[model samples]
Structures are given as structure tokens and as C-alpha cells.
Target: MITLTDVHKAFGAKHVLQGVDLTIDKGTSMVIIGGSGTGKSVMLKSVLGLVTPDSGTITVDGNDVQRGDRDAFLARFGMLFQGGALFDSLPVWQNVSFRLLRGALKRPKEEAREIAIEKLRRVGLKPETADLFPSELSGGMQKRVGLARAIAAEPEIIFFDEPTTGLDPIMAGVINELIREIVTEMGATAMTITHDMSSVRAIADNIAMLHDGVIKWTGPVSKLDNSGDPYLDQFIHGRAEGPIEAVR
Candidate 1:
């Protein structure tokens, strides 16, 4: 399991996370939901070590994240950035297997290319598209490529940042289902940050609500609609007249 105990973080005078205690069971999908500036992304970043916490203990499978080999620890996880952060100069296959081509997970060039193509196919992309550049694919296709890359290494954990941010509703739904399928098939621990309720419903096994520098509520996805927390109700329902400030 991935556990965060008493996690806290601040930037100058602005405090973000405050004593966040979250537990993500192994092989389950946990989606963090919150309004803007509620520290959702910050919390995710802290777990990834992109942003260090002021005080806390973050552990994966009982291994302390901060006290491990950075590269080896990271090798066990994969991240899908919000905007499909693909390199324009590399072909789709190269982008997918970028990690496999070098570093700790390095493989022969031909083997890496093969794995990339296989992963692309897993994400519903054609083999021929492997030779194309990111600029040539549509927004949805780009997201698929991003996902293929995320799963290319078959990491034990995957972090998704705004999985469906720019796609149309149908495409978004497709991505959500694809994510669910991939996670379920691989039994990978997933932590996703999204404001998309449709995505939360389709992808999460458990949901946690982050608000006002703390987690207001955390429970199974089935409990979301009836959680009885005004903050959660307001945010999920997209209501302007509730506990949450309308302008925040």
C-alpha cells in the first residue's frame, strides 16, 4: 500500500497540504478530487517527489520513498503528464519506450521498439502510427500515446495527471474506460488527480476529497453521492451556492 502520514507542505507564506493522511491500498485506483487551489496536484507531486513535503512519511509497500534509491524507486512507477508531454522530435514509438532505450531499464533498440509498438497497440493505436510524430496525431491520439508510454514499462504504480483534460466527452469517456481496463488488468496502484466527475465514477475504486489544505472526506466511490459532506456535495454537484467559495 501507499501511505502518507501527517504530510505537510508550504511555499514561502502559502501553506498547501496540512496533515494529509491518505492510504491507497495496493492494486486499487484512488482518485483525488477537489476544487482549484485545493492542493490536489501538490499532494500528488509530493508523493512523486517532484515536490518534497515539509514534514511527513510517504511509503510504498512499506518502503520509505524519501530514503530510497531515487532512480530505482522511480523505476517502479510511471507518470502520465496532463498535456501528453511528448517530445516533438521523437517518433511515437521512441516516445513510448523512451525509458526502455536508456538508463536502468535499457534494452536493445529493436527490443524497445517492439515493446513500444505492443504498448501502443494496447492503448488502441495502430502499429503504423509508431513512426509518426506527436504533432501529427489528434488530441485523443496524443493522449493514447501518452498512456501507452505510461504502461510501456509496466510499472507497479501509475500516476495520472488530468487524464481527460482536453478531449471531447466521448473521447474522455474512452480514455477513462481504457484507464480502468489497464489498471484492472495490470493490478497497478493508480493515483489520479482530476476534476472530471465522469472520470472519477469510471476510474476510481476509492475517492478522496481535498479541501482547505486537508482531506475533507475519503471513501469508496459508491459513497461519493451520499457522503453528506457539504464541501464534497458542492464540488461534485458543481453548485455555486454552498460551503465552497464561488470564486475559489
Candidate 2:
């Protein structure tokens, strides 16, 4: 559903993506894993056309990402940000239905609220929680809210950025399971950027390791352990000594 070929991006003296090539099949989950500052986020932003690349191309369903009606193009995607970026001012329902309440996807306020509630339920949140603010929720609840917002638009593509950050192990596991289930049930193409190996194991159908601004390895998740790539092995095993330096 998505493809990147010979993609490269640089900011002044800092060269980020040198030649990132990746493909995400329709209705499948693809996770990009790498250490901090390895350009994982930059790759995603390039695909989204938020950060224009210096060279190469990104296409969704064979259409060039950089050329399109901006609003129409972006409307097809939903994003769960790394920081659970909910508005402190808006109520839970408003936050979840932000897109639906305005722009081309707008719905009646009452209808939007109902859809928000349903999405919230899908993420294991309750109706009562809709009226609550982000501050009133726990970290796990906030993450669930973020997930709720991501799927509320019924987007064809979903992007998850560090889905399990800041949660306890148990909550992280819950979030991972929820993400896997939601993506499967919705039949949405998913691209997630996270270094969490546990999240990778639970949510990925295919895995790609990004290092030094390019994809070092890409394959089915089942073959990850036996891939025999030093960079990949060092990353997945969290080894202190390997091809990848501990200090970035």
C-alpha cells in the first residue's frame, strides 16, 4: 500500500535519510525499529509529506506522496503520536473527534460524539471516560485515548509513533495487544516507528531495521531472530557490544 524508493533527506550539515527503501503491504502491520536519532521519525514524516525529501520518491497505493491535494491526501491517514498528544483543554470526546468535527470529514456534533464513544470502547475505554479530560486519565488510559483518536476517522492508513512509551510493562502489553487487534479488525495498513522490541514482536507482521539513514534489513517477523545481520542482532538483543555503538 506504501512504497519508498531511494529516499534521502538532509537538514543542513546533518544527513538523516540517505537511501531509505521500504514497502508496506495493504492491510498489514509493518514496524520500523531503530535506536534514537536513527531517522525513523524522519522516514515517516517524509512519507507523510510533512518533511519534504531532498531526493527519491514516496508513494501510497502507487500515487506519489509529494503530489496531491494536501487535505485530501492527509485525510486518508490517522496518527497516534509518540507523546499521547491530547489537548489538555478539550474533553476526551472532542480530542477523539477533532478531525470529524471539522474539515472535509465533519459530522454533526452528536454523531461525532457517538462515533468517538464507539472508538473509545474499541480501545477498552468507557463511555463515561469521554467526558473526562486528559489530566484525569492514567498514562495507559491516555494512550488508549490516543489510539481511539487514531482509528476514529476509519483511516485507510495508520501510523503509530512509540505506542508503548511511558507505560508500565503490563500496560504496554495491553496497548500492544490493542494495537494489533484494532489494526487487524479495521484492515488498515499500519506503519509504526518504535525501538521497543516487545512491541515489535507483538504488533509486526513485517519488520524493517533503519540504521544510518537506510533500511539495513527488511523481512517477515518470523525470520527476525535468524536474520544473522550484526546490526539487527545487536538492536533486537539490546547488546552492549556489536556493530551498533551504544552511544549514539
Candidate 3:
């Protein structure tokens, strides 16, 4: 469903993505893993065209991202950012249905609210929570709201950036399971970038380890433990003394 070939991105002299090439098949979940300063985020942004690549091609369903109808291209994708990134001022229902309330998918407020409530329910949230602000929710609840919002539009593809970053382990596990279930049930292509190992095991069908600006390993999650690449082995095992240097 998505392909990046020799993608390169840099901010002046700081090279982020030197040459990132990855292929994500349709109806599958692929997680990009890497330590900090690796190009995982840059690679994702390159695909989203959030950060235009200095060179190379990024295609979704065979169409180059930079050569598409901007809004139409974006309409096919949903994103849940690292932080919940909810609009603080908007009520929960509005935040959940943000996309449905505006632009190409705009609908009557009542209809939008209905859809939002259903999605919130899907993410295990109570309908009455809709009228509350994001601040009123706990971190886990906030994440669920974000997840509900992401699937509210039911786009063909989803991008999850650090889905379990701030939550406790149990809450993170809940989110990981929800993501896996939603992606499977919807049959949507998914690309998630995260360093959380528990999340990696829960959400990935395929795992790609991005390191030094290129994919160092690409294989099924089942093969991750035996990939035998030092960088990946170091990462998955959380070894302090290995090719992957740990901060002091």
C-alpha cells in the first residue's frame, strides 16, 4: 500500500533520512523501530509530505505523494500523533469528529456527534464523556479519545506516531491491543513508529528497524528476535553494551 524508494531528507547539513526504502503491503501493520536520531520520524514525515524529501519517491497505492490532489491524498489517511494532540478548546465529541465536522467530509453537527459517540464507544469510552474537554480526561482516556478520533473518518490508511509513549504499561497494552484489533477489523494499512517493545509485539505484523537512515532489518515480528543484526538485537533486547550506544 505504501513504498518509499531511496528517500532522502535533510535540514541543511543535518541529514535525517539518507536513503529510506520501505514497502508496506495493503491490509497489514508495519512498525518502524529505531533509537533516537534514527530516521524513523523523518521517513514517516517524508511519506506524509509533512517534510518534503530532498530526493527520492514516496508512493501510496502506487501514486506519488507529492504529485497528488493534496486534500484528496490526505483524506485517505488518518493520524494519531505522539501526544494526544487534541484541540483543547473543542469538546470531546467535536475533537473525535474533527475531520467529519469540516472539509470534504463535513456533516450536520448532530450527525457528526452521533458518529463521534459511536467511535468513542468503539474505543471503550463512555458517550457522556463527549461533552467534556480533553483536560477532564486521564492520560489513558485522552489516548483513547485520540484513537477514536483517528478512526472516526475510517480512512484507508493510518499512521500512529509513538502510540504508547506516556501511558503506564497496562494502559499501553490496552491501546496496543485496541490498535491491532481496529486495524485488523478494518483491514486498513498501518505504519507505526515506536521504540516501545511491548507495543512492537502487540501491533506489528511486520517490523522494520530503521537505523543510520536506512532499513537495517525488515521481517515478520516473529523473526525479530532472531534477525541476528546487532543493531536490531541490541534494540529489542535493550542491551546497554552493544552496537547501539546508550546515553550515560
Candidate 4:
């Protein structure tokens, strides 16, 4: 459903994504895992057209992302950012239905609220929570609201960035299960960027490890433990003595 070929991006003297090539099939979850500053986020932004790549091609369902109509292209995707990225000032319902409230996708406020409430329910949130602001919720609840918003538009593709970053272990597991269930129910194509090995094991059908601005390993999630790549081994086991060095 998505493809990137020879993608390259850099900011001034710092080169990130030297050449990233990946392909994600329809109705599957592909998780990209890497240490911080390895360009995982940059690759995602490139696909989203938020940060244009210097060179290469990104295509979604054979539509060239860089050259497609911006509005039409974006309508195909729903993204849950690292920080939840909710509007603190808006009530939960409005944040969940932000896309449906504007432009060509606009719907009656009541209808949008209903959809938002339904989506919130799907993410394991109660309708009562819909009237609250993001600041009124816990971190885990905020993440659920973000997930509800991402799926509110019924997008064919979803991007999850650091889905389990700042929550308790149990809450993170809950979110992971929720994500897996929703993706399966919708048969949506999913691409997630996260450093959490547990999250990868829980949510990924296939896993790709990025290093030095390119994919170093790509394989089935079940095979990650014995993938025979030292980098992959080092990352999964959290070993500090391996080839991957800690940034000073």
C-alpha cells in the first residue's frame, strides 16, 4: 500500500535518511524501530509531505506522494503524533472530529460529535470523557483520544508515532491491544515508528530496523529474536556493549 524508493533527506550539514527503501503491503502493520536520531521520524514526515525529501519517490496505492494533489493525498491518511498533539483548548469531541468539521469533509456538528463519540468508544474511552478537555485526562487517556481522532475519519492508512511513550506498562499494553484490534477490524494499512521493543512485538506483523539513515534489517516480527543481525540483537536485548553506541 506504501512504497519508498531511494528516499533521501538532509538538513544543512546533518544528513538523515541517506537512502530509505521500504514497502508496506495492504491490510498489514509495518513497524519501523530505531534509536533516537536515526531518521525514523524524518522518513514518516517525508511520506506525510510535511518534510519534503531531497530525492526519491514515495507512493501510496501507486499514487506518487510528492506529486499528488496535497488535499487528496492527505485525506488517505490518519496520523497519531508522538505527543498526542491534541488541541488542549478544544473539547475532546471537537479534537476527535477536527477533520470532519472543516472544508469538503465538513459535517453537521451533531453528526460529527456522534462519530467522534463512536470512535472514542472504539478506543476504549467513554462518551462522558468526550466533553472533557485534553488537559483533564491522564496521559493514557490522552493517547486514547488521539487514537480515536486518528480513526474518526475512517482513513485507509494510519501512522502511529511513539504510541506507547509515556504511559505505565499496563496502559501501554492496553493501547497496543486497542491498536491491534482497530487495525484488524478496519483492515487498514498501518505504519508505526517506535523505539519500544515491547510495542513492536505486540503490534508489528513485520519489523524494519533503521540505522545510519537506512534500513538495516527487515523481517517478520516473529523472527526478530534470531534475525542474526547484531544491531537487531543489540536493540531487542537492550545491551549497551554491542555495536550501537550511546550518543554523548
lDDT for each candidate structure: 0.94, 0.94, 0.92, 0.93
> Can you give the TM-score per candidate against the true fold?
0.98, 0.98, 0.97, 0.98
TM-score of 3: 0.97
Q: How well does model 4 score by local distance difference test?
A: 0.93
For model 2, the local distance difference test gives 0.94
lDDT of 2 by residue, 169-233 (tens): 99999999999998999899999999889999999999999999989999999999999899999
Worst ten in a row by lDDT for model 4: 239-248
Q: Which ten residues in a row have the lowest lDDT in candidate 2?
A: 239-248
Residue 235 lDDT (model 1): 89
Return the lDDT, model 2, position 196. 88
Candidate number that wins on lDDT, 3 or 4: 4
Error of 4 at 72 (Å): 1.3
What would you estimate as the lDDT of candidate 3?
0.92
What are the clash counts of all predictions, listed in order?
Answer: 0, 0, 0, 0
